[model samples]
Target chain A: MMVPATSAAPQSGAHDKVPLLELEHLQMLFPARAAAFGGKRGHVHAVDDVSLALAEGETLGLVGESGCGKTTLARCAVRLLAPTAGKVRFRGADITSLGPRAMRPYRKHMQIVFQDPQGSLNPRKRVRQIIGAALELSAGGSGDDRLRMLLDQVGLNPEHANRFPHEFSGGQRQRIGVARALAVDPQLIVLDEPVSALDVSIQAQVVNLLDDLQDEFGLSYIFVAHDLSVVRHVSDRIAVMYLGKVVELSPAEELYRRPVHPYTLGLLGSIPIPDPVVSRSRPRQLPRGELPSPIDPPAGCRFHTRCPGATDICREVEPPLTLYPGGHEAACHHPLNVSSSDIAGAVRSPAASRSSGSVVPVPPGG
Target chain B: MTLRDTGTGHVPVNESAVGVLDVPAEPYAAGAATYRLALRRLRHNHRAIVFGSLFVLVVVLCLLAPVYARYIAHTGPNVQHITEVLDINGKSVDVVSLTGVPVGPTWHSRFFLGADADGRDLAVRLLYGGRTSLAIGVMATAITIVLATVLGLVAGYYGKWTDGVISRVFDIVWAYPALLLAIALGVSLATGGISIGPVQINSGSILIPTLVIGIVYVPYVARPIRGEVLALREREFVESARALGFSNFRIMASEILPNLTSTLIVFVPLQLAHSIILEAALSFLGAGVQPPAASWGTLLASGAPLFNVAPYLTLAPATMLVITCLGINVFGDGLREALDPRATVRTGY
Candidate 1:
């Protein structure tokens, strides 16, 4: 099942607009299985090599299952965690190893809204102090005016300032969280599972609010979530991550229409269609087996163990992320196509019929 | 409460298949601050009111101990009443009563509580006893709270070497029985009158018992608070505060301290009760308030030998001690309810 492509624009068509945030080969490994009796400690490879760039005013949706390093990647993207290795550039300035005091100036330009709305806001703090705290730190404008404006911008009652977080419902609490992030006037906001904790009915309201806020403030967002439809709703370009590495990156519509990697193909097949007539007619071809342990991950392609099209080449050699024309790219030795029998029986193939060389070297894009 | 989508027929018919809408939402709002909420809870607790009143009464009576001794009794606690103040039956106490034997209750006289073997008015001495006992408890509790808080904050906020060292030191102090430890300190520093470098403390000084009581309870206070601060360090709010670029000091004050306020309040009265009861036990063992400055503990000890004759001498001060300690304990239990931030309103919907 494929949604028709809406736009012809390539992902990297314009190079002049420098991305507000860039993460290069970022690696975050939780150090060691602790030794109870002084044995050798082993590293848990939480986030292996990951590289990404996010332009100003663009929302890059990152989709993956739990424990796939999506949350860790969001933290690394916002410079919340110093990566084990790799460069984090904020508008051409390196912030990877900056001291906390040195990172202060950059903090205003980047912010994060946590997953759980009620858990994220301090349970003891009133809404006014929660939002006004940032204002006090930045020391901008009159306190009351700024607080009322923030509350109003997030569609919360100005009188809500006196309320504690537990007094509000999930959606309303999330608005308070958004207001807090907006208080500093940040250019980039990394929203970690922003709507996963909400009711299905309330999820859309928060999504709409986020979309409208993005338009109003010209904010760049790295929306991390496990829901594909929610990601598709707000993102322009989508990055499909598996085991910390981005497996596929393309324009949102293009990736949904024709995903090259087998993992992305399996992911796209799993999104349920609402129409009963069409949904019952199609077969849901989900990937088999549990996600492999990151501590002792299968060698070569991290997805090879669960992948339906795992050839001998896939088990021995890791595939580099190769780009096709129109800014579509995937890291897979065997790209899913019409002839690939393992995918869904009614899978739609890409328009280009030529089966070129399997491996293509990539040039890093700005 | 579960949320329902606002629009049923408002959206275009073509877009009805998908569950998507841009409806405005009204968030829940209440205007009560944390302290306001806690104060409200405190007001509704009847136990807090009753016990707290009892404790206040005890404190006021202790504060007026000197006035009761001066005007009512007309004799200082250390003054020898002899035959002047005591009126037994219809006659004043003669030399026989003053010669180291306990006396019975006197009628319509300054020795309303009767006289001890020293011929001192037990009534005046009882009043002075309340002052010394309460003073030792209050001062020592203050010292224990301050030391525990500072050490706990330092150890918890900065772990590894600091936590390890402080924890080991606490373990060592906790290994010994608290009373035995207090007895050791009293024998060394209190028994012979403390003289350390520039500071000099006489054998009869209340400072000796105060120091002993304060140092003994440090481990108990520090252990629980250390556990709390360690937990607070891992809370998501602290991480969010750091992400917002607030300094560690600001985070500790604004994020950490407010959450810890209830825990701190609950410890105060509990620790105070413990200090007061401990001071009494130590004084009974000759480790507290020396001669000339008699607490309930020391006076009770002096009257133990003459129990067969004038049980009132020991009974009066003993009753005051029991009442004060029991009142403090009940009052402390109610304070816990008052300080608990999440205490539910149980009287009505």
Candidate 2:
């Protein structure tokens, strides 16, 4: 808990400039009732002690398996679900505690596109009403002209604006979702597994549209997905979360080239190679066992149960995220694909350096 | 799979167009197109049309009760003509026989559908009774819907102490069987009537039965609406609305309420049918529509004892009640089928 207060300032140093959005020590815990009578009460630590920053015009990909709190973190960033504890600074203003009315002006600056295209749209409302409602709420320009222009911009026919959402294809509906987010002209848009629900063929189309839209509008994005292959194409920087904690935050190219975290290595290796010979030849690095219950997570490193490289130190004390060259970060006592000298220099926390004697080769920075 | 080249994370603009509708696009026809589509679908349902028309016919005839009484029967619903003689087919007959039995159907302008033991015109009474029954049914339904919708929306949307208080009230009401509750309320209110603020309703007023029947069935309707609202509030669109900075009230009215429209519409006729039956049950037990004024239930009560002597007296009102209830139910089913189009056409890639 005390780690965030001391380490938050240095964490923002990765961005090298004033961030467009910063989430400091964000935590979200859902109170869960006991399954049986007179049982002890507990909280599901969905997101715990996560700090991140997004510079202007940057896309940060959040990659993790299901229930790793990627979606929760994204929602918290947009203020959709207020974090139980944290400071969310958007454009240098603290917005975590702002009421809906107080947050209205800031709403136009950030928007989110949901995962489900069908469920995200009102089925009864016409296409015109669906997008127009957002336009109306923002108090933007003339409704019809702007609506027509939005339809065109998203690559949908303007003439089909009167049709219902159910009448459109899955890809088309997703485009409408993107168009809705863009209607307010937001600077930072959180794409929460936007293309996951789409077909493989249609996924590329929507992803391409999103990519084009970002460059066209000079917008920043937090692209969240479970597939590393999908996130690698659009993300400048990728953050890998494991059991409510970020195990790795690295530059996209550097992460693929040399993944330091065991969880990140497992995720990258899980992506299939098309060539059968190469696919079979490569060692399967998929993590072992199902995800442990979030209500009572593992005591030390949450990934120690699944990590093959787990040692006595990994089982006793959780590793702090150590920064390597070019802003690459990974939290692991025995980091893969890194020199012992690099680990000695990268280890920032004294507690981690003391517990893991392997990195005692070099003197501490302090 | 063509991975867009450029380790710099280039934003791709795929020229593969998603425009151009496969289905022929119609000219913009706005303004409650959903309702229009429902109406079009309803028109194709023969059962709804037939039964719906039957209900309408009953209502129209009930509304013309005075016309039938004055222009045809020449006797009011409560008028007694026991000693009077009527000519039927050129033969003179007493309205009530010498032994105190009422005359049967004269098939003439007077004594139509025969007379009750009191020598009152049963036909005139039947129509007037229908008017009263329909009125109570409609008014009670209106009361139930308005109260239940407001309560359900509030309780479901704001789930805390507000939900606790309102839901407990619903449970208390729900614990009692609807008929028993209505009877209990009806018996108490029918004696002294209701007086609140500047408004007063008489003991024998139809409004008494209406009010009793309305309050009793609120939990039945409200429980469903509240349950639906709970599920609806969690939907992604609702979250999207909140993300857009919509107020709680705005989200409830525009976002949640419109989705609930079909559910509410389907509930209307089913509730109407339920309310009418309950009203009839209450009136039969003598806790409804006092003397002189006639309802189907009261008529049933008055005619049941005279079933052997004048069976038509009982049969006439009973048949009307059955038909009305059946018609509304059948029509409600059709409306549900008509409105249920939530499944959209999935376009194959």
Candidate 3:
């Protein structure tokens, strides 16, 4: 199930080795419940066919609007929610179909940190028991020494391990959550909007702590966030999602410098710049109207309804993720900031070949 | 508009968000376990302590009934003196007047607190009656809580068809008024007795009323517990436990059950009071404790006609019932407040 879209790029040193995690044409559809009598309506297309690869010791930032499938993709990656059709490969093993007992060993290799600090930690349990359960399960050790070490690693006082979750500040409680994920020494940690519930100053501290932990443990992360600026700072590569599809994916700096997809450009434009002069004068490419309901999304490119560059073809034909130069990929016929030479060099990604059967058509040079 | 600079060149922490970030520990709450903290809070509540003591006193006094009857009163609970003269402060008082009016307080050991219409010692009967009432209350509450909690947890956690079945059963039980249901079950169970498999309970046994009252109030306690379990099953901690590869049983036992402790604890005293009152009501209506076995309800029933002659019989039992109920309720309220973690003092950061 590991599609070789990124596999084709051998020169990109990270892709040369087997990817640590791969989501192959993953789709997660939730059956819509009728208003009365538990009847099944049409399914809500939460995560449409999205394929991505994460190399060992890399951070893949997943950014999207509130209703987009970034969080769903993250959950699917960890097998918290098994995908509707596609595959989730961890360390080259197809774990999407593994049963709970069979998935235990694989679970030790992957962990997730949730969004709400307070909600995630059991209020009745002390820090020791909360993190200790994971540690004991994976390593068969419940030593307080190791518990204290994990606490220290997460920038919390080791003595605080005996305390309950509510006694700590929000940031400290979040640290306890991080410590629990780290307890099992997982290689891949899926952070599902971990710092969104925190204050700005505390958010920086937690983000820096995560960065330091990643380097210390050589951990890979799929950092899901709605905050584009935070994702820009942390992700080695970023995937921009719009209504469940990976609209654009590129190297982190390239995504900011030359956003190819119109949706990506709109997301970047929506970020408020620090300087008032630039903020006022800068062109806003922010998408118009609210996100379309995922229950029955529009027929073409899901973003075309809100895309600034929507045309007749965009409304009728679905766009394939065409690979551009520098390993950048975008699923748009009329991509923003792409020159004629760049379009001339583009190739259709392997995962997209089955869906659309054609490369993204080059717009008649305006 | 100005930001304070830190000497270490670190970003300024948000005062409210990171208040407890650097605090070593709470001064007063040093190494306090959650329950220990709750215990300390309970200790500080004057009303709970006072009422709790009162409840303890009532229980202790009732437990000493046999001793009081044998040594102190020199009379058994049902040993009636139909015609006996007693000396009270150099005055001769008949235990039962010729007109069948029972004697008033003799202020003496023989007929202390006076005698009932049957000419039995009122104080002795009251103490013995307390034993029966409290036993029924406690036993019935135990039955109710154990059955309700298990059903609630199973229904709430498994949901779907299991929830559908268990919830409908609870609704069926809830449909009838508590008194009506207890009376119905009591009346039938009273005459026929209860025969479950090899177990046999006699018609006149105290267990009949206990079983009736227990089964009747199940939906009252159960519906709330089911609602709580429903909300608790969806809490993020339960989800987190599932994500940790913990089995469903482990999640329900460790994650869900421990969180339900406070709710269950608060229910115990409240349910005890409710069960006691229900038992009294049943006894009063003659569907509860039968003749020869004394309860506050029976005492009140036996004393109703003698209101003009000897009101002490009815007044004594009524006062004890009110005191017991008030004590349990006040203590229950205090326990709830104490168990609430938010009610305690925090370590300022």
Candidate 4:
């Protein structure tokens, strides 16, 4: 019921500057044969019209359920997966259709961190070899000092380089993955749920390490994850996706406080509050049905079937993201309009109500 | 075991003598420490060990054929004429020297096998034949492995035009009957139609069969290797290597090649067996190793006519061939199973 915080608009002068990485109407479809009792051959909408932008030194959080196309979008952003349609511009140059040979130079500037730390690393290669592989590929640095510096940058001992991946802990392996990405001194890193496979305690350490490294290198990150809390912590701007489509996007504080899109609200509601009393006091709005199959998604809004305020209009036509008074945007026919006072009144627990001031609501339309 | 360290957190330390990291090493746990593990696995596979040992013994014998032939049959001393040494009374003397003339009534020796119908020691002939067989197998297999590795890696890694061209070429080669090509080449060699530089070597010699076998089997070796390359080329590590800016060649050679070691190790022995059997088959058909040189196949061929009278001739060479091939195959199977990721770890007794 809490009103979300409004995101401050960027100064008019700064609006003219180009984004470091930009994807316009990106779509990636995977062709799959129809089921045995099925109608027609269909394509899995792995990524559907996902458009996002990352400015210099910005971390854009892309959160979604599994099969929601976050990873696919991340890959497309880095040109690992070619977009079925739309443009991917980096530094004002369109690189969406760049050939393999042409994309080679751009690879040095952009890199990706895979989700599964174990699967991401080459089991046959030693830690040193894995790290050195990137360095050797990009011709990053010469001599032992730079190599040692790369290792040290990731908080790993340079001496431990000789060990194979099997010899490293999950956290350490992920660090090696990060080290490999950073080998070429890349400007942007598409971190595809880098810490999801690690232990809960280890996740914090990795996140902190990434934060430290980002600060040190002044690097922009396209952080993809399903964990909203983690996304909130790491991201400057957050994009909530469902069924291969972005439902909402806003600054971290504003998105959490005023999640106008029903899917985003459901996502926020699903996060377990540490305080039992506050969690119990808040009204839970769990969506009834499972996600629709991407092969043939719903007629209009992909989330309409699960949207609390879904109507005929939602089913008939997909709503494009409409900018609110703040810089926050949400693609919802019927958006939430909870007031700060209402949120304060609704809270049963004094402890919960005390923290309600920090929650600011984003307006429905610009 | 703590949950943190049990499933995913266990890190293997590289304890190489030289602390140089990134150097490729076998995945077996280091030192005599894990000897127990390998020993246990090997022990459970009794047939494998027995067969592997036998194969090793055969290879060792083939390598030392010159020494054995010299000492056992006195063949090295007189390659032209092998006469059974006689005493003053004109009766054949039983030379006690391991390298002395063959004096036994039958072609049989303790382990040297036997002599041929022409008074040539069968044991010596077998050893000499082994020398030829092993040389051809090793040389031909090396060529196959090298050619297949390069072509397969290039085709699989690069895909598109390179893959298309290599695949089509292999398909064309494969569609042509292998045995027919071998026979055609063998016939060409027989007619002195094919010449290498100044050498006017006869087609019936070992060289012809070796060349025929090598050329025909190149596709066989390349196909399997290509399949492996195709699967591995798309692996995430390969992508990661590319992301790191690794040149295509380095990725193929250093990153990919090491992974295919177990496959190569398993295939080499099988290839050797195949070459040997094929050579013997060709010789039996009168298209392989000519007389005087004395291949097991030629010996077998000679013995076939005398089988009703002296079955020992055919039985002797055939048995040697069967044992050698069986041993090689068993060892190769053992190696394949050992390299298998699904193989259960046995605690050696």
Estimate every model's Cα lDDT from 0 to 1.
Answer: 0.76, 0.82, 0.83, 0.71
lDDT of 3 by residue, A149-258 (tens): 88888888788788788778777888899989988889999999989988665677787778778878888889999968877667888889989888888888799999
Candidate 4 stretches greater than 4 Å from native? A1-14, A34-41, A137-140, A273-281, A338-366, B1-50, B68-72, B76-115, B158-202, B215-227, B346-349
Report the alpha-carbon TM-score of model 3 versus the true structure: 0.88
Clashing pairs in 2: none
In terms of lDDT, the poorest run of 10 residues in model 4 chain A is A347-356
Maximum-lDDT candidate: 3
TM-score: which candidate is best? 2
Error of 1 at A281 (Å): 3.8
**Mind giving the per-residue lDDT tens digits that candidate 4 earns over A30-64?**
99887788568899999887777788888888998
Q: What is the lDDT of candidate 4?
A: 0.71
Error of 4 at B245 (Å): 3.2
* Per-residue accuracy of model 1 over B125-219 as CA lDDT, tens digit each: 88788889989999999999889877887688678899999999999999999889988887777769888899999887999999989989998
Q: DockQ values for all predictions?
A: 0.29, 0.40, 0.29, 0.19
TM-score of predicted structure 1: 0.86
When only the first chain is scored, the TM-scores of the models are 0.88, 0.90, 0.93, 0.87
What fnat does each of the candidate structures reach?
0.30, 0.48, 0.29, 0.17
Sorted into a CAPRI-style docking class, model 3 comes out as acceptable
lDDT of 3 by residue, B125-242 (tens): 9999999999999999999998888888888898899999998998998989999999999999998899999999999999999998888888777788888889988776776676
